[model samples]
Target: MAEVHRVEEKTFEFEVPVVIVGAGAAGLVAALAAREAGADVLVIERDSVPRGSTALSAGLIPAPGTRFQKAAGIEDSPGLFARDILAKAHDEPDGDQVALVTREIGPAIEWLADNHGLAFSVIDDFTYPGHSARRMHGLPQRSGEELIDALRQAAEAAGIEILCDAHVTDLWADATGRVLGLGLVRPDGSTDEVGCGELILACNGYGGNKALVAEHVPSLSDALYFGHEGNQGDAILWGEALGAASRHLGGHQGHGSVAHPAGILISWATVTEGGFQVNLNGERFSNEAKGYSEQAAEVLRQPEGLAYTVFDERIAGIVRQFEDFRRAEAMGIILTADTPEALAERMNVPSGMLAETFAEVSRLKAEGARDGFGRDFSGVADLAAPYHAVRVTGALFHTQGGLVVDDAARVLTRDGAVLPNLYATGGAACGVSGKDASGYLSGNGLLTAVALGRLAGQAAGRRVAIPASA
Candidate 1:
């Protein structure tokens, strides 16, 4: 755990109006927001280059009522988006939080594109499991690497200063959790203390921490961590130390579609678009359509902790627009065959059993019935030759739990009291994904990151501006 300094009477090297920790989407967005609101902001990143969980993601964000949706003539609203989030999470999250993110996310992303020049386009072709509409927006490639790079470039262009390779190890504050300054340690063991009138924690969750993973999400304790290594629970731990409230520490985003051994993220589109998963026994284990996050545990429970995503050529054409899918195609990691038996042979699974699984799928589609696992295959088109498949395994993408925050993104105490001069955003704050991976709707992570991040920055900026005026 990072130490919390009592700061009875401390001196600082320098000061900034607003200080943002972590240079990922959340931090950069917060910096940009604060800067836009007429506040001087400083962003501190542990890594030399800014690539947190945002970089590892598909870079998609779910936002309704945006111009993109309007241009596409897709009728949508924040209420619909909020409803989808609750439906996916089984209404386990705070309804107000859901409403807050849903309401603000559209404007947040729109501000980014209009002001920061992010080339966002709505993904309307195929829908994610829980989303009710085609509201996902992303850059041209739809890659997180591009998203983060674009944000970094945007921040640089905005004249916001970013301190790289500076790992925050301590929070200097009073007992009230009113953060005053932070201690940063460089890779070369150098230290600096910088004071701030307001602080926003955008450092994200604890997915990279093995002990935390074991303590909370024990089922995925041994699962592959696909998020940024910098997600070490710094915000959660420090927030706890500062008497801030934390919730649903076990909640996380887990994906069952990571390409096995090759370390590539296979998009869930393959499964959502009439594809299915089969274990090494070449049998369908669970309904693959039950959301990819929950499918992680399902995949891990299978033999050898591995599963294969089986789809068709048409599905491949639909998914090729994604950068990761194209990379997998270029690497020739996706196996294809003219028939089920031939594909089973290529996948080294039992041909008879694989054929049986295919037959079952066909039966369900033909009968328009639900499977034993509750997956409905009636609406989707039937799979045809040539067949395509990719061997995959489950992995932890990021934890969806941390300190609780309010509408203004102010960090709160266990008693529901706000902590002054402090805010948490992104994975640093409790997410809307209920209490487990199953609750994760696609793009939930980025929704809060960009939405809550902007809100926090604006509130912090207003707070600072008010006092200066006074």
Candidate 2:
């Protein structure tokens, strides 16, 4: 056995049936499931509880074909959801993991509502970019905090031990490469070791770890400006130490840029509002009527990977019409100017071109186009000035690519063999992100995280342990 270092101040060991490395959606759900299976669960989070990627997110949970949908007269199934996700995967996602998520999503949603006090309001037939149907459900808190709150309550009531600010620095195993436990660093910088029957890594991606970001996704070397502060990719590295292989290490799931002050992601809202996105040259780029992800990609292709959304005084009404817009903009998502020329000047785009584009949009509307930026643009309210513009660039929420796993959420090696006692879920696992070619389905992340977490949690909990000497 490797030398186990003991903590001086507290020389104690707590053995649990399972040790979960992250406290985000995946880790918490895993803990919940493990406890349900009668396992003593220890959840070690790098940050305070409910303080990771999920907390910073808009809590859009997408699980197709539920009581919400059935009651609303919408017909769907896990098979249809799976098919749509696979189609979106476009051959890039791990086929097995995708299948697993589709299978377990319904149960996961049920679990959340039934056990975790997660109250959801279903938007009847509301559809995102890549999804075929409007099956996405928004959480009550409308933020990741709500989901975390529910998960935390359930886990606590289940007697799960949660260690916040306790970072697991390494994995501990026997000489035979049989997994044993983890080496954790407490918040005080002192390290301690905890042994467990199984270790679950739900520590999220390396969006904030610029070094890791540069190492994995070099394309965004300098572009990795924002993400959860604690997302240092410890989970991936710890898995590697245990001989686990990971994919899409540096892959980026781009988010639409949040505005300057509020900096809340606003891709969806921007697209929904009749906003015109102008490049640095003041030229309209992309099909504005398209999804936010597509718009974000278009923005990232520009100079400095930045653009501006120009709108007029009517933006106030539009903002009122769409709560997402108001929330995002009120959170510093919108950059307003009193005049079109001033807005153009502030955004550094050509004033003449912006004026011309605005005029063209008006002309197109007059000509019977439905909306601006290649939509019908007909009969829509023209953008009357008191114009405003907000700077936008492609931001990233999380990467979808990760360690390939089977339908059971078992992590697989490059040769396709499963890593013994290993499983993965959440953004840390490979997914069908860009499968849609246009973009991924909105709320896909949460959907997959909760579903796969439950699946992996149950599977890991049920896994029969091999004797240490065997």
Candidate 3:
């Protein structure tokens, strides 16, 4: 809500064939795609730097049947990936959106690697909660910072002009919702009007807006808002104001294991690879294998709205590839103990109860039994002495829903007609997550970000020039 205006009264200082807002993963990828299609692109970023929510993620994008997956000897297809999403969502989402993203994800990933010089490698070691295959692709560092840095480098190399610190306050359009230009408010109180042949809204969702979060995702109203400050729902608000249809506004992505106070994301790999969560009462709550998105609320619903992630040194070695975990280790947040009692002592929880919890977990895993909460302990390794634990709290990461669009990433009016020359991608568009945070499978954000971004850019690059009289 910084300002989303339909003010059509501006004089143009310059123009581009394609203008993209919010130069994150989505916007930058869109610029690249447009450039490839022979369009001159301008990526306008709100921040002085280009890092947005993409810098706050694990930089993982799930794609099926990619070269990375093939090299890992993992068999996966778009059908199986779609099935995993539908099965894990537990509620109905847009079937068309699911199918679109699944189909485009593989091609998008390969395109970035083959054309843009992004060194993507599949996470072949372990799978996330709801994913059956090792399809998570990331850069060498496996951090969102590296991801955004690479995308920015790629955009710069493509000669895409990314105007930084020029806050886009108004979107200019005619009565028909056909975009004419955008008004940018600069730092010195000066303004510049830039005409565009086509516009792409890649501004992220409304997680940082407390009023919107309280209004939509009330469950995370008091949770930690960990998204970028620029995610003020400008695209969503602007699209809605322009009579665009929106859906699932209450949906979002949340995390249960962000290191408390430290504020770095503890990769969910710690849980999916056999670690578990327990509250201050030294009791397991929901099945930890359940998706991390839902676990945010579960962790927040605990006694003190906090929980602990318990893992072994072996699991620590597995997750060390993440820059966040390595940072936590550097900060001494990953406490270690030689026994359950000792670990509980370090955590200041009841030693007796902690020992009992560990014993129960070991018994269940040894016997290949299922817990009451429906998490199967079968075939999973048990945590031994020299265990590692981190105090964590739940956090609201980002909103999942926004303006509704078709498979081609065109913004649709409430009447189901396409808005000419305007598109929404990334958090501006409705994501693959179905209804709420619980339905967010891992990598759904970046999957749709790159996939829809490329689609929108390609479509925008091919759009016809605006009529002279408008």
Candidate 4:
């Protein structure tokens, strides 16, 4: 931990209706929502450039029964979404949190699109793992950068001031535990205090902290971390100091197919469309249908933590619309060949074994058989001529747990009591996923981020008693 300057006795320099720490998706959304609900807002970010774990994501947000889904003629509901989460996160802590997210996701997304001018549409082409319907709503580019850019634009237009390079050092509170203001250290080592009636912590989790990872997620201690370096568990530490309760500290989101040298994410859509992963021995190890996060542990256990995603031209074409996949292809990370043998030769694997693997996949698809690894090839197509492969490895994207909060996004103590005037969202709050990498359903990160952010901002706005014009 680096030394952070905290002055216990100093006059606060500024005051706002709501002060948001960490200008990622959660902070930006909270600012927008708070301002919309008639509150003055300020967002302080650690990085000079505001790219957090949210910007590294695929920008997919799952919201069942949204107007976009209805326009696309897809039948879904929050009940179904909650059921899917419970099914995946069985026996995991904070199941109610999952239910709260499911219930509010639709409205949260709709509010952003309708009121904040955010552009989002239903991903009607294919469904992600654990989602019975195509409920993913994303920007046109399907990139988190685009989403963040849009949110920043909206925040700026709404008069939300985002101060970058403002690293928050501590929260100023009285003996009653009611947060009064925040302490910050500027990049030049200058310290300042900013007062606020309410505070929202959106700084995210501790994936970049090696000590926290080794303590909570020991299984992935050796895996590569691909999330933002700014997520240093400040929210968790601050919450702990405030006597806040925590939940699901072991849960995380993992990526199974990060391109080895290029470090680009290979979209899971390719795997769902027909692609498969094979180890260096030219042998399929686990079920590709298990989804990216769930398959990450399996990929980590592979020989030297290396695997190849083998697909055909058809699957590539189907998934090329994704910005990351297209970027990978443009970077020459995707290898192409006319035959399985040629592809295997290009991958430096035995041609006979690779051919045998493809033959087995085709035979199983033809006979409608279950694979030895419990993979079902029901909807996948047989690989045709002109194959494609990308060398990839597993990586830890972000932690999924932090300060436990109520449905209103107010921070809670171990005894289930709310901490006055303090709230948490995004990775700062406990996630809906279970206490493992496998419990992460697609888009759960952004779902909680945007939804709880909105809830927190609205609650703060109403509680602050600020004028509508402020």
Q: Global lDDT of each model?
A: 0.93, 0.68, 0.90, 0.88
Kindly provide the TM-score of model 1 when superposed on the true structure, using C-alpha atoms: 0.99
Off by over 4 Å in 3: 2-10, 464-470
Comparing 2 with 4 on TM-score, the higher-scoring candidate is 4
Better of 2 and 4 by lDDT: 4
TM-score of each: 0.99, 0.83, 0.97, 0.96
Candidate 4 on 1-470: residue-level lDDT in tens?
43223344446777887999988999998888888888889999999877898788888899999999999999999989988887777747576777788889899898889888889999888779889999999999999888998998889989899999888887867655677788889889998889988999999999999999999998788998889988889899888777789988999998899999788988888788877999999999999888799777888899999899999988887777689998997888899999999999999988999999999999988888889889898767899989999999999999998899998999999898999888999999998888898888888889889999999998998878655577
Q: Which candidate order results from sorting by lDDT in descending order?
A: 1, 3, 4, 2
Residue runs of model 4 more than 4 Å from their true location after superposition: 1-10, 91-93, 466-470
- On the 0 to 100 scale, the lDDT of residue 324 in model 2 is 48
User: TM-score of predicted model 4?
Assistant: 0.96
C-alpha lDDT (0 to 100) for residue 91 of candidate 2: 52
**Per-residue alpha-carbon lDDT of candidate 2 for residues 1-470, written as tens digits (9 for 90 to 100):** 11332222322376666778788888899888877776677888877655677777766777777888787888888778777776655656566666667667777887778877778766562355566666777565456666677778888888888998787776656543345767777777898877777767677766777776666655555653446777666656655655667775544566655554456555354444456777888888777665554455567788878777776666555344334455765666566777667777777788898778777777876787654345766545666667777777766667655666777677766667777667777876766664322436677678767887887788777753333564
Candidate 2, residue 153: CA error in Å? 2.4
Backbone Cα, N, C clashes tallied per candidate? 0, 17, 0, 0
Each prediction's Cα RMSD?
1.0, 4.8, 1.9, 2.3
**TM-score between candidate 3 and the true structure:** 0.97
Candidate 3, residues 212-302: lDDT per residue as tens digits? 9999999999999888988998998889878899988998999999999899999998887788999997788889888899899999999
lDDT of 2 at 143: 64
